[model samples]
Target chain A: MDIIEILFTASFWAAAIRIATPLILATMGELICERAGVLNLGIEGIMVVGAFAGWMAVYSGTGLWAGVAVAFIVGMAFGLLHSTLTVPFGLSQHVVGLGVTLLATSATYYAYRLALPEVTSPPKIAAFQPYEIPILSDIPFIGEALFSQTPFTYFAFLLVLAVAVVLYRTPLGLAVRAVGENPSAVAAQGLSVTAIRMGAVIVGSGFMAMGGAFLTMSAFDSFFFEMVNGRGWICIALVVFGSWRPGKALLGAILFAAFDALQIRVQQTEIGAEIPYQIFLMMPYILSILALVVMSRRAEVPAALMVPFNKGER
Target chain B: MNLRKNKRVTMRLEPIENPTMLRRLGLPAAVLAATFLVASLLAMIAGANPFSVFGLIIKGAFGSKFAVLETLNRATPLIFTGLAVAVAFRAKFWNIGAEAQLYAGALVTVVLGTGLLPWPAFAILPALFVCAILAGAIVLLVPALLKTRFGVDEVVTTLLFNFIFLLFISMLLEGPLKDPMGMGWPKSARLIPEARLPRIVDGLRLHWGFALALISAGLVWIIQTRSTLGYEMRAVGLNKEAAAFAGIPVNRVLVKTALLSGGLAALAGFSEVAGLKGSLTLDLSPGFGYTGIIVAMLALLNPLGVVVAALFVAGIFVGADSMSRAADVPTYLADIMLASALLMMVLAIMLTRFRVVRG
Candidate 1:
């Protein structure tokens, strides 16, 4: 195949879409949690936990959807754990979050080892099947490649829209946002501030878990130790870059994902050889830093973020 | 009859809710302790004695003269990274880029080690040290710029840089710095003999780097306790607005401390390459930056306490490796131990800072 031909292959874009899936969903998950005033630093660890939980359920014959379900359950459990420490325990928010990340990293990595100590080959499940959009698949140079993506990719797109709605149009969404901005005011208005934040983390983390589950069953088809990597942290930056809006965060994810997709595409073209692969790998990180620094002056973070609310003082 | 009796159940209640600090940690501490107990129990289930397994890890880390020295050797970088974290944490700055800064420092040392610049023995050593410090400072600039200029959260910026530096180092090793001696191994050329850190023992790998680590700790302590910059940084950490109103040059102080923190961390990275490996490799940090976070907390952000915390944590990590090899145990046991210790430290440290009320 010529360079163009090879670049246009269905599998290549599938891989690109695959790479974008976890980041897109996880970032959206963070977008919700942060907008509600809880910086769940455990997103990486939570993603890993979801990966392992999803894998375990599927590996035991529950099928792929069950794997995704378990991931959500796992996410909710962690959300509860983190909320208890920061919200009620009134511990240092950042430290607690960082601690959660470390704990999650070691727990999941070690657990995977013990559960599969004797297996030489990594466990696998039937990977997600690609579903091509009927008419869109016919577009030249883009359709078959972009439209024929795994079902999870499409789900990620829809969830972005869903989150945008829940965050703006609904009463529960307004309350969540209110709690993040000023919990004292929310509490005074007869809302359970902790409950709103907790609910957001629990629900948001469920999406993040699906991001992890998608990795095992849809994206890559197996669990690796620390599978989520640092995409969770990247999402934190994206939420800021997007100004804490769901629709905006998705755009940021795609933009970064586009940079990621472009890097992989350009690498295959021998033209990218002049610049080392490290530069390409570092592109996402570099972009994140640049985007945050360049556009952050007017950035709006949740006013009550990282602050503990005292029920009595309010 | 049974329903009627259940409706009259006794309502006895205990007056004390959380009798001890440990009780408050009942959930996590229990989860953590039970997890280890079960992990150790798994060792027993794996046909190894749990007690012996634990004993072997302790022995492997400190049983022999070489083992103890090696543990100290491994921990040298952690002291600096831990301080890097502590300084930032104290100043309320989240500089997770210590890992990247570590690589930046190592990269500079590699350039110097491979004769990228020419100077006398006396001049080359000092110049390389300064270069390593500067390399670290440059990498930290991204986060500082984002935080100060754009109001971007430094946590994410610094974190993203960690991966960037790692990838940058990988590219260098695979391209400009590839070893040409034998095979396709990805490491830079070995350092010149003169530039190598002097070893302390005849047979052991322990070197003057350990002393350098001690001196670094002392310098950090003096600055934090004695100097005005340290006072300003600490003040900013407590409350940025208040410090700024008091006429503390907040931005300048933050930038300077960030550079110092990065530079210090870079020294640790440089030492590891120069003193231990004599070259650069991809596995430069096995999460020293992450571990430094735990060290900072364990030390309560006290610079002097950082040394003790570093050694203790290093002992656990190395001990785990040793225990794993000798007892046929998984090295992950050590991670479990460290996690438990961190949880313990968090609970203990928080007690001194704030009071947990029943209301």
Candidate 2:
């Protein structure tokens, strides 16, 4: 099929939305963390732990929602460890974040081996199936593309809106934003900057794990190694692309997913047949670098991002 | 007057003007004990006796002459990558793309060593080494330039480059670099015997790469302690604004640091292929670049310490692999131990300069 013909198909849009589901969730998660002034480089490994935890829970006969909860809680446990070191000890965020990633990933792998020692291939669980909304499903083109998705996709979209509201409309959001921009100002206001930053990291990390859980529970049926495959890092770039805004970050996720879907389809076409498939696989990372270069020039980074705040220190 | 006031005691970290020798030594010992405790807990969860597991690991690492040599072989690449990370981190450049640079070096090695060079072994070997360094240097230069000119964050860009470079290498392996006579495998053609690194001793599996690594570590130590560029890098890392004020070209120093770091990491790939593997494959590195961060951190970013650190890290992996076969626990326990060690070491380093005081 030609490029234009592919773009017109509802399947393409449906695939793009499906692809964007995890990115949307994870980007929102990262946006929250960055907005709160902590760069969670642990996103990648936390996502791995999430994928394994959620899938393992479901595989063990827990309900789907319970699996998600399991993933979120486990992710939060790691986040607590992360925040404890970064916030209270005021360790180098870069080193501590990477250490957390290493810890989470290795711990997950060890757990997976202990849980399923005999199986060569990962066993599949009955994952979340697509749910068609009553009226929205009947719309001509848009309905099939957006409404007819797994409950996970719907939750991801709703999260963007909810995050946007909380970030701009609520007092808690203001405090969170204040902590990232000017922690001393927030501290002067009799608010605890440490509490806000730690809380933001913990909650934000839960969302990131849910994004990972979406892959095994919604996108695919089984947990596997390297399945998250740099999506977490892409979400980091998306936060930059969105300038740490929820709505814009959601859009960035979808746009990136669309390109991803397009590349997968393009590989099957005649023009794609002549090029090495690895070239097609490389588009997402290359595009992320381009996007980072384009947006970083004007991106308004959090003023206190990566800067540890020691209260009462001159 | 304050004595009559309510004295609320709360713990807070206070800067220490000078740490006593015992405090410096005790903190690190405590950190090691903490890491060991965590590892023991993990072993218990895996249904293995923690003491036996620890015993197996130590025996497996240093039991036989063969085991010691195996660790030295594994440590060769780590030493290079660890030095690479230590140097860049010392400059505060955050060069996390050492994995990609290592592959870049290997790619160059295969391209030139696979009958592409018709000269004598002496000329061809040096040429291949120089080209590998150049390739790795160029790969990292892109991100460094982006950071310097476009105000981009090197962390994300460098991380992204790892994925991109891997795909690029995959393309080459499947297309042009594909071994023609070998069975279907995504690997490059083997290097000529002339291009290979000589074994350190006859009948010994160890190669000259280990010697090169030791020499490299000594050279790096000298550079870090005795060179002007090393002084500039330390100044930049300590305080960028102050370094710039002191007439150091901060951006230029960062770019130069990237080249040196990338080149050092590339040597790992070169050594792996030239000294042992002789052919390039996708799994040439099992996350050596990422593991280098652990090594660098554990060493406190000290150049000579990186050598000792790399050896220690390699022993764990070599030991863990064997221990897994003899025990019920998974081999990834090594990774968990090292990661915890990294975190604990960083915290301990901080405690050496700052004391938590109750007020």
Candidate 3:
């Protein structure tokens, strides 16, 4: 088949949206956290922890929703740890973030090995099956692409709207944006800056964990060491590419996912098979950098981002 | 007015003018002990006795001459990378791309060393060092240039570059550099005998690379403490605006520090290739670049302290590997221990910087 014929298909579009779901979910969480003036470098580790915890829950015969709940809890715990260190203790954000990642990633590996020692192949569990919306499924190309996804994908899109509303409409959301722009101003207004930041991080991390849980429970049946495969980092980049907005971040995620879907499909085709596949894999990362360079020119980042706020000190 | 000003001067946490020797040493020691205690809990969770696990680690890392040699061998690359990170961090350049720089260096070394040129034996080592360092520096040039010209966040750019270089390596390995006789496994051709570094000990994998690592650390220390470049870099790190106002070329110093960081990390790749693992494989560095960040942090960004810190981390990893083989303890426990230790140390640093006072 011609490359154009292969690219123009409902299945390809469906795959693109499905692939973008996790990025969309994770980027929203990161956007909220960054909006609160803290960068959670621990997202990568938190995702891994969530993926493992959720996988274990499902493996132990718990329902998929239960697995997702477990992931949310684990993600919150790690986020709490990150906030306690970076926000209250006034430690270097980058250092603590890296430490958390190393610790969480390694701890997950150790625990996985301990749980399933000497297994020849990875243990498996039944994954979340796709459920189609009744009337929406009957529509043309857009129907299959948008409506026939796992429940998690549906929740991810809904979350984009929910986050946008929460960030723009509510008193708590105003406090979060104010804290990111000027924490001292928020503090002067009698709101506890630390509390608001901690809340944003915890809530954001829950979404991140949901993304991880979705990966283990929806994308695949079993957990592997490489399952996350830098999606967390990609989410970080997408946040910047999206200019810290929910709708833009969702669009950016979908774009990158389209590229991802395209690459995988091209790799399997005769015309593209002669070229090494690594070139295709490199495209998304390179494009992220270029996009950042362009988008960053007009990007309005939080003023206090990455700076530790000590209430008593200047 | 004077009475009101005096009343406003309430007791609070204040920065120490000069910390006592006991306070300086006691804090890190206490943090270390606490980290180990937490790590023991992890061991217990894994169904292993913590004490025996610690004993096994110590025995495996430092019990005999062979173990000690192995520890030093493991530490050799860490020291180079640690110093590389320390130098850049000292200059406030967040060069998270050392991992990529190391790969670039190793790839360049393999490309130049594998019968590419017929240089004299005495000239090959020096040629390799210069070429590798230059290649590593070149790898970081784009990021440095972008940061200097456009104020790009080096952390994101450097990190993205790492993935690019990794894919580049995979492409090279699977295609042009694929070994003909390896039965389909992707790797570069083995280095010539002259390209291989000589052993430093009687019967150990330890090589002259260890000496090179120590020497590099010492030179970095001197450069950071006793040289004009070091002074400029530190000035830039401390306050770029003030440094620029003082006629110090801020961008120049930052770019130079970045190149230096890349060069030093590339030398780490050279050490690995010349000392152990004579051929270039994708696995030549098992996240040594990332570990170097931990090492540099644990050392408080002191150039000379990186040598000691790198050796200590090397011992932990080497010990953990052997412990896993000798006992039922999983090797990942080492990662947990290292991470906790680093976090604890950061906390201690904060504590040492400020003291709580009664009102």
* Number of the predicted model whose DockQ against the real structure is largest: 2
| i-RMSD of all predictions | 6.8, 4.7, 5.6
Off by over 4 Å in 2: B1-11
Instruction: List model 1 lDDT by residue over A235-292, tens digit each.
Output: 7778888888877777778777766877877876668867777777778777877787
Better of 1 and 2 by TM-score: 2
lDDT minimum window of 10 residues, candidate 3 chain B: B1-10
- In candidate 1, stretches whose alpha carbon ends up further than 4 angstroms from where it belongs are A1-17, A133-147, A312-314, B1-50
Which portions of model 3 miss their true places by more than 4 Å?
B1-13, B356-359
| Highest lDDT model number | 2
DockQ, candidate 1, vs. native dimer? 0.40
**Of 2 and 3, the candidate ranking higher by DockQ:** 2
Better of 1 and 3 by DockQ: 3
Residue A115 accuracy (lDDT) in model 3? 88
TM-score, prediction 3: 0.96
Which lDDT tens digits does candidate 2 get at residues A212-292?
Answer: 999999999999989998998899999999999998898888899999999999999899989899998999999999999
Query: Per-residue CA lDDT of candidate 2, range B1-359, in tens?
Result: 11111343434678998899988899888988998899899999999999999999888888899999999999999999999999999998998899999999999999999889879878988888899888889999999999999999999999999999999998988888999865889999999998899999999999998999899889988988999999999999999999999999999999999999999999999999999999999999999999999989888898888999999999999999999999999999999999999989989999999887764
Residues B69-135 of candidate 3: C-alpha lDDT, one tens digit per residue? 9999999999988998899988889877889999988998899888887888878888998999998
Every model's DockQ: 0.40, 0.55, 0.43
The order by descending TM-score is: 2, 3, 1
